[model samples]
Target: MIRFGVIGTNWITEQFIQAALESEEFALSAVYSRTEERAKDFAAKYDIPNLYTDLESMAASDQVDAVYIASPNSFHAKQTIVFLNHGKHVLCEKPIASNAAETKAMIAASQMNNVLLMEALKSTLMPNFRAVVDNLHKIGTVRRYFASYCQYSSRYDAFKQGNILNAFNPAYSNGSLMDLGIYCLYPLVTLFGKPNSVQAAGVLLSSGVDGEGSMVMSYKDMDAVIQHSKISNSYLPAEIQGENGTIVIDKINQPGSVRIHYKDGSVEDITVPQVKPSMHYEVKEFIELMKSGRVESTVNSHANSLAAMEVIDETRRQIGLVFAADLK
Candidate 1:
């Protein structure tokens, strides 16, 4: 029952349309807003009968087949290649662009319109992030993977009373490592992958973006450290270290309870049962990969969104944090 269609009314698109109406596998239909009175007041506060201010007439509509796109990040690879060249199927919202050549041109327009393109990045389709990737073999010999997600930004007090908006705008590529350190680097590149070296530093916000940061990636014998901030607030609890224990991830953007902690001290809570506005498990894995026709996502893969956009373009090239779609 796909249907969908949405582009940004914020509050994370009203919590992804209230987790796509508690998922029967989605059906909302339409919503877009360049302002047809804020898209008919966000389609009459989410009854969503269809309202757009023309994004190519809701991507040349045939009444929507897919589109979640939470816009801004230089308009996610040209609005996901104009809704995958109008055939639809796109669930963007993440650092799926603004680098790595607009994520390889939105994964080559979802492989030249075969459709289905994910990356909603709800922490690796979190069932407590697949119970921390199935208890990571009981944390033995993993090495290290600390993550962090800072909060502090009720629009950073109107950007410290200067008012930059668009989340501290850098021409809408926004910051804090593309809005909260790509949720601690997409679950540390979905449980460790791309990192041989990264090293970073930040605290820019003179409208150059990145109001906070810290990175360090190097990996063969693992090293991860990836704190992030919108200007500070972390309750701590995002570890992975190993040699027989420590998984603990209370929330790297809704990991929602996970624990392991052993080395003989003994503790385990390999959380799995999660379903709520926890973005209904990435919209039920993007409608079960578009009803098994599939086009990407081996747990949000397009080679893990181009290796998390090449580790966010080498941590915004060693933390200078440039954007304007990284100079086109």
Candidate 2:
């Protein structure tokens, strides 16, 4: 079994640990938080053997073979590089880093250390997601792709009341585009390669973070439009239009169902049933890749991470959204 240390105690981190517990090849060996009490509480809740407030101590410990980082966006690169240099594989949360430069640095660190590193882009590894890729051929030549993921944030009410939380704070590198829109952009890059150019626009909150945004990616034969917002919700599904048919995705993030609509006026369901908690698939892939001494994921490859980041970086450039990390 590959013993793992966790680097954050957020809800997403909890979901990952739950998935790890169900997997045969993974064990929760340690937990880390900036506060001792928080770390201890997390460890107690999961029966983890060790609790650490110092990241270096946890990285140097004999108890862990890898670590899953779910820390804030600004911390991903620095924390990941530290663990990698100490000879531990890392599975970092998605939107891999604040920008492409940091992503390249993290990739370089993984290569230099000869350890596995993967973005925790769980959607791409989902069986249903692969089914979408596999069935793309039925749609013929793609002409257009449109994806949107917008959910009304629970913290938005607080923001309206003059209290800005980290989710909407620019200092944390958090916003609608970085947090929600990435779900749309990653899948577009996964299905179709990088676009020739990108144009974007967004509404900025008083806190200097994006509240809602849209982008149109230009390709040779088609254009992909991505819409995202955290102040509202969208019930409409995402779609890919082609010469012969269209592929309908139920949701951009979780993607429980996918279907095809043909020119002949027929519809077919092509959904692939997936295991629960969804994060299980990503964990399994990470463990298998590490066992084989691979440094990057084939599904959520380093190139994939780079391409997605490039789009995000360009989009931010067009919309004038700058994070503190970009200044460094």
Candidate 3:
């Protein structure tokens, strides 16, 4: 069995760990936190025997075959390299690195160690996404792709008052685009390769961070306009339009359902109903990859991660969104 360990204790991490316990291919062996007290609490709650504050110590542990890095974005590059150097596979959260250069370094480390490494983009694996792809015939030749994920953040008010939290801080390497926009970008990259050229513009708050933003990735004959905002709510569904029909994904970020409308005036509901949260797909997929001892899966490959990161990196550059700690 592939023994898996986690390094974060967020809600997403909890859901993933529970799924691992139920999965036959993976075993949950360890967890890590920044402090002994936090680690102790999480370890007792989850029944994880091993816990540590140091990343290197966790990487050197034999109990884990793979490490799942769900820490902040800035730490992804360094921790991934550390895990690879210690001969453990890594599965990281989206936005692989702070920039393309750092992303390349992580890729090199994983490849040199002959270990599996991937970005955990659950949007592409959810059944809702498959339903959208499976019924694309009705849409004919795709002409446009639009995705918008916007939610009024409870922390935004705090951010406005200058009380910075990791979720709203540029220092932590987060914002609407990095957090929500990636969901839209991953599916677009999966459905359509890299764009011909990308134009990104966003409303930068006083803290020198993105409050809300929209990006346009242009193609020769088509376009994908993506929006991720922490300022307001949007009624727009992530959608596709063609010569004959259109498809609407209720929520692209966590697409619960999808529907298609053909030119002949017929509406088809392709929504997939599942009891588990949308994150279950990503957890199960990671387990499958570890069990097969595969460096990558056909559904989500290192090349795909590289391509997606390239888009984000260019977008950050276009918007002048450089982090304070980005080492040259």
Off-target runs (Cα >4 Å) in candidate 3 are none
Model 2 ranges with Cα > 4 A deviation: none
**Top TM-score prediction, candidate number:** 2
**Per-residue lDDT of 106 in model 1:** 84
| Candidate 2: tens digits of C-alpha lDDT, residues 213-312 | 9999999999999999999989989999999999999998988999999999999899987757789989989999999999998889998999999999
> Cα deviation in Å at residue 44, candidate 1?
33
- Name the lDDT value of residue 72 in candidate 1: 89
Error (Å) of candidate 3 at residue 322 is 1.1
Which window of 10 residues has the lowest lDDT sum in candidate 2?
272-281
Q: What TM-score does structure 3 among the candidates reach?
A: 0.95
Q: What is the C-alpha lDDT of each candidate?
A: 0.85, 0.93, 0.83
List clashing residue pairs in candidate 2. Answer: none
Global CA lDDT computed for model 3: 0.83
RMSD of 2: 0.9
lDDT at position 249, candidate 1: 86
The residue pairs that clash in candidate 3, if any, are none
Error of 3 at 264 (Å): 1.3
